[model samples]
Target: MGKRSMPEVPQTSGPHVPVLLDEVIAALSPLAGKRIVDGTFGAGGYSRALLADGAEVIAIDRDPSVLPFAEALDQEFPGQFSFVAGTFSELDDLSAGRGKIDSVVLDIGVSSMQLDEADRGFSFMRDGPLDMRMGAIGQSAADLVNTLETEALANLLYAFGEERKSRRIAQFIVAAREVAPIVTTLELARIIEKSIGRKPGDAHPATRSFQALRIAVNAEFDQLVEGLFAAERLLEEGGTLAVISFHSLEDRIVKRFFDPAKGGPAQSRHLPQVETAARRWEKIAKAIKPGSEELARNPRARSSILRSGTRTVADARPTSFEGLGMPMVRGT
Candidate 1:
């Protein structure tokens, strides 16, 4: 658990176009005097919108690369905006003493800023270090790929990336690493491509492997679950919690949080079966996807799903990660 080097000043990632902007804004309905947490501040797109709507925004991001964006936004809005250099999982503690949070917006997964910069190692389109760490801390993708056994690596790819050819890919990786350590994004991508040749008009062969490594390096699913629970506790009664997830794994967690049936009983193993109230959400609107216009302008919204709910008066309850559909990698 050590901090990685800070990225260079933000690269030009085009204009910040947050996915499902209008839809999220409508769900939040931020107004003057309202306090909201942009749990994944990324490029500050959501925070900027909340501030413009007269809400006080507490922005959170673990990657130091976003500091320039966060700092500039703070200066632009003065007291209306503030930045917290941390993960969304700690939103409750981070927002403590900030008063009752009226709403929390979590746009999960990698951000445009990270993807656009090859140095961040979030994308294989550009050759860079195999360091897919959102928080810029702890063991990196290079560490896992080099150290993990063939079976463990394959399991990770299948569990996290859902890569059907995980076994073949892992075998190839193990063999290749014997000659030389796989250290760069392109370097690993080449190995996967060599094992499973890519076809024209199909997604990159390395897509799933890259995704799997990034998820493991960041412990993204676990963070998402904790972040959701923290939002449940942080939001005032009748407050809003909106989450935008990029893939099915993430969407599943959000879907369960909003549906009481999938949430199971509101009791934790350590707590009494009887509680004053269930600290879960009262389901709100159905899953919202980006419109045609948004898709045309922002291709990143193609796979995004937005789920939202209103906080009920129930007390926040304890829950397990497995209950939220989070898959575990044994012996990590």
Candidate 2:
């Protein structure tokens, strides 16, 4: 686990237009005097909006580079906004002793800021080190691609990315790395492209592999499961829980958690009475997608799905990652 050198100042850019902003706000309801947690405060879009509506916002992000943006928000609205540098999986501890949280809004997956910066190595569109680490600490993508066994690598690509040509791609990667370590985003992308020639109207051949690598590096699915449970613990009775997920994997986890009926009887009976923990969440809304206007303005919204639920009076129950159906990977 290597740390990237941090510059004195992080790159500042135009505000990110959050996906499903209006829809999320509407789901969260009555803002004034409420204390909310922006679980993934990438560009501070949700936090900024929440603060404008007179809510106390506790923003959370793993990337240290976003601290400058958080600092600017704190200065703009003194006492209204604050930030903590940590994964949303630890939101309960991060917001502990803050009293009853009124809402928890999570915009999951990679942010536009991470994707736009080539130096961060989140996207193949721009060449940089093959380091897809959201927290700036962990086993990087380069480490996994260069060392994991061929079968293991193929399984990772298939499980995380759902890449159909995983075997062929993994074989190519293993062969190529023998000559020289696959160190850059473009280098890996080139191997994938050569392994599976791109077809017309198809996305870049590297798309799935890149996604799998990023997900593994960040342990995103596991984090989402824990974060959901953490939100269940943090939110006050009748508080709102809003989640915006970018892909099916993320949306499935959120949807299944909010709708426990979809998932059968309690596997983890940590509670004395399982029935008491049964109805922890209520009024779970149907999934909401971005409108045509939003899609036109921000193409990023095309894959986003927003799901919400109201916390009930039932006691929050403890759960495991396996109970939440998160796929496991070595070193995650």
Candidate 3:
């Protein structure tokens, strides 16, 4: 029998420049003996910095490609670092039996490593396969557009991408796909551009469609809700949780979770208002943005917003998954 071939693994080189590096480090306030979770350890930029500051770091990512980099860092730091290959939403499971974590930092949205690589299909600027699964698994953006009904597609585009012409775009996609499947990023981009006429000085015609597709493909918003709640559960009293979000959808979720709100309208007339205990996190700082210096260095940092909060000693009951507006999946 011939030897079976192994699937090719994506190769990543160079380091992902950590955005707002100094700000994140300052917010985290890492010290010796503190255990921290770098939830999105893309290329270990933040993880490397955290370890250098003498904290015990558990760095994690959904992309298994990052495992090699983690291994390299483990060798460099030995006893001070560990890596887990999974989404931050599974923080509780990943930290099972590990006890409380002192701090958790999440750098959300698409990483530069993913966007810069044409093969990953994250950017419309670079043509590649239509696959946009962040973890290299499950349905691709191509699959969703090719398979979903026009109404569902339109809703997804509007809700996730905040695209205004979702119905028109969805109609165009459905019509185009009937003749031929949209197999690549360029194919979809062209269809969307045709549906919605581009403005004179518009950024790219397909930007919103691509963004919508990526969000749907990866269930990015859903995972974010879960991850935030999971981080809240994992933090010890006085522990800090910091998140960097690239879009308003993500920022809104983080903002609401950190703010005080009752779970829902009174369950019944007899039941008193079930005010959610004062939020577990006390907002430490207003949303932080990259200064002109950092933005000049990395334009991608322009939309990024960083929000940090410290956990209070009062045990605020964890928000139910549904209460957080997380889309429920059978088994994610």
- TM-score for each model: 0.91, 0.91, 0.87
- The model with the greater TM-score, 1 or 2, is 2
Where does the lowest 10-residue lDDT sum fall in candidate 3? Answer: 1-10
Q: What TM-score does prediction 1 earn?
A: 0.91
Q: Across residues 1-332, which tens digit of lDDT does each residue of candidate 2 receive?
A: 12212112234744367888888878886899999999999888888878887899999999988888899889988998989989999999999988789999999999888988888899999999999998889799999999999989998998898898999999999999999999999999999999999899998999999999999999898889899999998987899999999888788788779876575675566757545346888999999998897788788789999999999988887866544556555333
RMSD each, Å: 6.7, 6.8, 8.1
Deviating ranges (above 4 Å) for candidate 2: 1-11, 265-277, 328-332
Clash count, one per candidate: 1, 0, 0
Give candidate 3's error at residue 324 in angstroms: 5.2
For candidate 1, give the lDDT.
0.85
The TM-score of predicted model 3 comes to 0.87
What is the clash tally of candidate 1? 1
**What value does the lDDT take at residue 246 in candidate 1?**
94
How high is the CA lDDT of each candidate model?
0.85, 0.86, 0.80
What is the lDDT for 315 in model 3?
73
Model 1 lDDT at residue 21: 82
lDDT of 3 by residue, 160-268 (tens): 7888898999999999999999988888888999998888998787877788889888888878888888888788689999899988878877776776453345467
